[model samples]
Target: MWSTKQLADLAGTTTKAIRYYHRAQLLDEPERGHNGYKQYRAQHLLQLLRIRRLTELGLSPASAASALENDNSSELYEALTAAERELTAAIDKFNAMREDVRGALAGRSFGDLALQLSDKPPGLSEKDFAVLLVMSRLFDAETVLTFQEILHSSPRTPVDEAFDALSPNADRKEREAVAEMLAEQTRTRTPENPPYSTRGQGLAEAVEIMEKSIAHLYNDAQIEAIRRSWELLRAQKTASDT
Candidate 1:
């Protein structure tokens, strides 16, 4: 016979837990002696040990009754298998997260441009990204990559750089120099409908989306440079017509 504290110590659980099990009917109540002191017996120890074993096997207290009555060995086995599967999944997730953390530490730029376009690349605005997604669908992956490179290079004049590097405040001399260099550069890279041009419904949407997107990022001088660049193509086409 043992007191509640003694029984708790022997069972390696708390007295409160033992009392809870008593309320749960998992542990039978001990009988009170004439001195009004209740004492726990070996039966109590056996019951608590069984409860702990079942719980360690992942059986819920509510389901313990079901476990006791039926041939739940198959259920217990299934539960253990399910627990193993969950553990495996958790490990896989941890490994992936660990790899990501390592990449971040190394600054390897693991993010995908096509998928995570709206994020990481701070140069592009939200509107710019939406249009780019359309471009991915419309253009070949190679073409899209080429365009990304082009955007990074982003033809700029010596004058534009000098002014930007010096001060944002515009000057006529610098502006003219910028315009000349831009015209020269744009003349070289103006869009020519190639054999592999992305055409049809998607093409129109892509073009429209792209135009609408960058409408604000470029200034009037930049826009003029682009128009001047297109003039060469227009002139050639006009000559052919004549």
Candidate 2:
């Protein structure tokens, strides 16, 4: 016979974990001795060891209990296979995220734009990065790729860089000049209709989400520039379609 602490030590686990198993009813609690101390037997040690092994094999507590109760049966095998599949999927996801982090740190462009995000762009802030991340979630892969192409191909000027640095307190003349420049630049380039724009039902919701994000991320002057440019682009696209 052994004490609870002794049994835990023998099984290479903590006394708290042993107690947890007892509370979970995974391990049977031993009866108290005449001296009023709980006496643990070899059977208890074996049960604890089995439970520990099952958990180490990636089985949850409930699954481990089920696996043990159904030992040497088809149920046990099925439980183990399910656990193995979950572990494999978790590892695959972790590896993919690891690769994305590596790509970001190395400043490498990837087919997946989310993975290629740098800590910050020279003329952009974390707000811009966050908006892109949200867009990735809301849009399909093809739409995101088209957006990336437009971003890369669009012409940049000193005015655009200055606009990125604009504050809410920017004067009216500064805002108008920036908006006019941006509108002219947007008019000269052509982009595919975004996926959201074609969704008659989803368009309003998508626009609301994107506009909210823009409001949170950009100052008044910057937001005005974007609004002005979008208006011009919409007019140009309308004319071309006619």
Candidate 3:
């Protein structure tokens, strides 16, 4: 039998911790001497060594003490392996997304333009962007990836230039030219999943907000040009519906 201090020295822990372990019922109560000091024997040393071993293997103190009985050591090993696999998958996906962002910056031009155009407040409202973000959530990963590819197309004409250019004082002819060009461009590359698709035929509120934000960007004559082109677009849609 060894004294508490001797046991603490041998086990690399404090006598107080040994006492606490006994209180926790993890270490069995040792025998007491004539003077009433507790004496720990070989059994206590072996149990503590086992506790340290299991602690090194990621088990809690209680689990470490009782691991032989609970069958959790193998389970912990498998859980660690599963977690590693998930982390690897996440890392690979992040790397792939980074490559796409790099490619879209130059190779996939329109996609980059959309991001640039969206940099200003009310230029491409966060609410509108939020609607686009929601569609990505609703679609499958492949569909969302395809939609991203569609955004990379270059602007087809001078109106695309005006729409993207950030000048508030663009003339009526310039704005109208852009409106006509955008209408033709939009007709050519109509999205299979439009932001307004979820709203179906009832897109008045969404269109109003978008149009209002855009209207505030240009002068009175520019507004008339834009309004006429938009009316032409509405007429085309109405004729198509019939």
Candidate 4:
């Protein structure tokens, strides 16, 4: 017979851990001595050691308990296999994060987003980056990469500068002209079969998120210009199909 402290020492664990196992019912309650102090036996120490070994192998306490209750080796194997998969996924996530950090240290723009693009385009404002980040989340990785390619290849023209510099109080004619130019730019630059399809189940929700992001990120004039440009593009597509 051994005291709690003595049993903990022999098992290479702490008294607190032994108490926790008692609470969890992983270890059976030992007999009490004449002084009303708990007395543990060799069986209790061996059980504690077994639990420690299973936990060190990444098994949860419940899983360790189940493994101990069952005599089947397959059950223990399955638990270890699951733990291995979880560890691998964690390792991959950390490795990707480290690469992103390395890219940031090398003076690349946009952190995780920058990693997906082949080259960073000049003149992208903070608002533009914010919108692009929102889009990246709304769409899939391949779609974002394709969009980044288009952005990199399309040089910003004087019309783009005009739209960017447009005032909130700009007249309707000025806004329309900018919209026309933008619509034409989109028509020419955008692939006939774009990577992002509107047929998905989440399309409405995704569009709502994009609209909200645009509303939050851009000025009133810029938002109006974007809306007008989209309308113009839709009209052109409709006319071409007719």
Query: Which has the higher lDDT value, candidate number 2 or candidate number 3?
Result: 2
The lDDT per prediction is 0.51, 0.62, 0.51, 0.67
What is the per-residue lDDT of model 1 for residues 68-136, given as tens digits with 9 covering 90 to 100? 445475664554454444444565554544443344334443232232212324464443343344454
Local error of candidate 4 at 29, Å? Answer: 48
Better of 2 and 3 by TM-score: 2
Clash count, one per candidate:
0, 0, 4, 0
Q: Write one digit per residue (lDDT tens) for candidate 4, span 48-162.
A: 7667756754668999899878855678667756665555456655454444333433455343334232223565554554455456556755666566667766777888799
Locate the minimum summed-lDDT window of 10 residues in model 3: 112-121
Candidate 4 regions exceeding 4 Å error are 1-84, 87-124, 198-205
TM-score of every prediction relative to native: 0.33, 0.43, 0.33, 0.48
Give the top-scoring candidate (lDDT): 4
- Give me the overall lDDT of model 1: 0.51
Query: What TM-score does candidate 2 reach?
Result: 0.43
- Please identify which of the two predictions, 3 or 4, would achieve the higher lDDT against the true structure: 4
Worst 10 residues of 1 by lDDT: 111-120
lDDT of 2 at 99: 47
Residue runs of model 1 more than 4 Å from their true location after superposition: 69-71, 83-242
Q: Report the C-alpha lDDT of model 3 over 1-242, residue by residue, as the tens digit.
A: 56788666545578888778778777788889999998765556556644543343334666555544455646544533443344445655545434433343334533322322222223333333333333322343344335444444443356655666724576666767767776676656655334333223244544444344334345555555556665767777888889
